[model samples]
Target: MNDNILNTDREELVARLIDRPESFTDKQLEQILADDECRALYDTAIQVMHSIEPKLETNVEAEWNRFSMLHSRYRRSQRKWWKVAAMLAVVLMSGLAYATIQHMKQETWSEQKATESIVSDDTTTKTTENKQDTMQVQTSIAQPRTFENTSLDLLVGVLAEHYGMRVQVMNDEAGQLRLYYEWNPALSIEQVVDQLNTFEKVNITVNDHTLTIE
Candidate 1:
């Protein structure tokens, strides 16, 4: 016979024997025992059924209770897996949220520091520029003007005006100094006095606001 037909027959024999073993007649047992495969299947089924329950419950309610217990345990196992998966999802989302917040905070802090540094640099630069402007103004006020092709007596008069002093020529040699070369206009009154002392046969003295040249 085909495998399907054989399996069907084996299922029927196992079910009938498990339900009522004493219902089968002696003639039917003899016929089933004549086939070795059927006899072995029957013997194994009887052993399994007896091992399961010595006095098997015959009511539908007893079978339903057994099935419900097995199904409940299976459902509990499935719910446990779902619970674990839900907790893992929650943890992963929390981690992502924390990382995003930290990144945003770090970016904000960096930008704020950069802005502060730029403002500080600008303030320092403006302060330095103002100081330089003030120094330049003071230098312009104290600066002397250039002289070109000027005589000694006239230069002495100009120097008197430049130094805010009186010019005096005590000897004829004092009026003979003629300057042809360029002189730096930034020279101080003390420096000019020292230069005037280098002339031949000249004696110069500066006392407060009077210039005496001999």
Candidate 2:
């Protein structure tokens, strides 16, 4: 016979033996044991079937319980991670809100300070202007004295005699008498001028009012 026919026959025989091993007739047993190769193949098939048989019902239950416990632990671990993630999100949001509030407060305070500084500067400027106006008003109210022609000549003569100075009288743009003096030593000019300005008979003021030298 061909190899394919022989293998098919052997497989069919093994299947029948596995299906009804106790019902095997003596003739079937003799056929299976007639060749050493056939006997070895039958033994191997029977051993394989026994090895592959389903486990006991109790063992199956135990395996199922172990799988359930392992699955439950895995689910618990996943839930814990989820909770940690949620807490982290909440904390981050709270921190963000606090930071935002702090920044706004700082900005508000800065703006307020800037406004206060501006107001203070404006007040200071106004006070300074007021003080200057008061001083000017006081100066405007002061009276000046007049000088006689003879007193003026006497004053010039005194300046020439005591300080070795020469005095010149000229007319200003407003047709008023302007007194000028020259001294021999240039350094003595300021001193001579100051002394002449103190003379009681000379009018030393140059504005609209007369200032009598005293």
Candidate 3:
């Protein structure tokens, strides 16, 4: 239809494109594509015609048998659809049951862990409280002895006697040195000796209950 390119209707163009593609010259095809609406219509007609697949040679008996076979299969599947639906229901119920059981197990395990944690915390708290109570009782038992301006010789004599220790004075000056100090009986004898040596010109040490002063 190159002779009537500008005047062709939709039917004429679609018929020629589907049935007689060779009827279109390159120039005529370009002219059709150049028109946007005509090109869209042309493409749509090709897709629709190819999809429908018009039968050129009809085998009547063969077509009938094929249609009957497809219709029979469809009917069979329709009748058995209830079986498939029942199987899916059973599978879903089993999954839900398994999930519920697993959820229950998880909750039980979590509760056990929570119970154990609470018991552990209680045990630790009790242990810490007992240790603190013991320390407080020990501190209360030891009464500190204070000597304000007491002579070192007398102080040393009392402390040595309390611990059943022997006292040695290297010089009379060191033995007679007066001191203001608080002696805690709570401290070990060695610790008391160390504190005494902190004073000026006081060198003292205790070994095996023997208090040595130099």
Candidate 4:
């Protein structure tokens, strides 16, 4: 019974020293460790304390604070990356839109220039055609042509078309009169009338740009 009581006292003292090492003075601690059983119990307690020393000293709150800080930094980095990506996307789209508009403008200008060129070419072609028509009329009047036994009406019709004149016959018989003549287109209508006046039974005259036959 006394051994049991001594062992219980040694166990309690070792437990109390482990909880609070300053609880015993050095003299009292030495006195308690003087017993082999009490010293053995104290050595076992110190070994247990050493074995679990890292777990006892660990700071759970400090580790949690470090983890939270790391998480916050990771989130910030992700947001920064997303912002950079968004900025790059916006710049790329704007460049493409600008390029498309510029290309369209260039195409419109090219089309306008092409249309202007076509219109200018058409205008030049119309001017050349008008000039050609005037030259042909003048050349036809300046050249000479021979009529072989042609009717007076046919001759007068041809001359009127070239010289812009009106013709009249005193009677229908004069229109049917056939003549073989080499026409001098350069001669005036009055001179031609005088020449026709010398014909047998033919009289021609001109007045106010009109030619009359009798």
- Give the best candidate by lDDT: 3
Model 2: runs farther than 4 Å from truth? 1-8, 21-24, 59-214
How much lDDT does each candidate structure score?
Answer: 0.65, 0.53, 0.73, 0.71
In model 4, which runs have C-alpha deviations exceeding 4 angstroms?
1-122
Cα error of candidate 4 at position 140, Å: 4.0
- Candidates 2 and 4: which is better by TM-score? 4
Query: What is the overall TM-score of model 4 with all chains considered together?
Result: 0.40
Candidate 2 per-residue lDDT over residues 100-189, each given as its tens digit: 699667656765775778877556655665697688655543322222222344544454444454544442221232233333333343
> For residues 121-182, what per-residue lDDT tens digits would candidate 1 score against the true structure?
65565566569768966675565543433456676677777668898888666566554323
Question: RMSD of candidate 4 to the true fold?
Answer: 54.3
Clashing pairs in 2: none
Clashing pairs in 1: none
Model 4 C-alpha lDDT versus the unseen true structure: 0.71
Local lDDT at 213 for model 3: 68
- Give the CA lDDT, 0 to 100, for residue 174 in model 3: 80
Cα lDDT tens digits for candidate 3, 1-214: 3475858785567557667767788887777667777778788877887899877898989787645442343445565786887799799889978976996676567657757778776556556656976886567446797664567778888888878899887777888776766789878888888888867677777877777767
Residue pairs of candidate 3 with colliding backbone atoms: none
Misplaced by over 4 Å in model 3 are 1-141
Better of 2 and 3 by TM-score: 3
> Between the candidate structures 1 and 3, which one is better when assessed by lDDT?
3
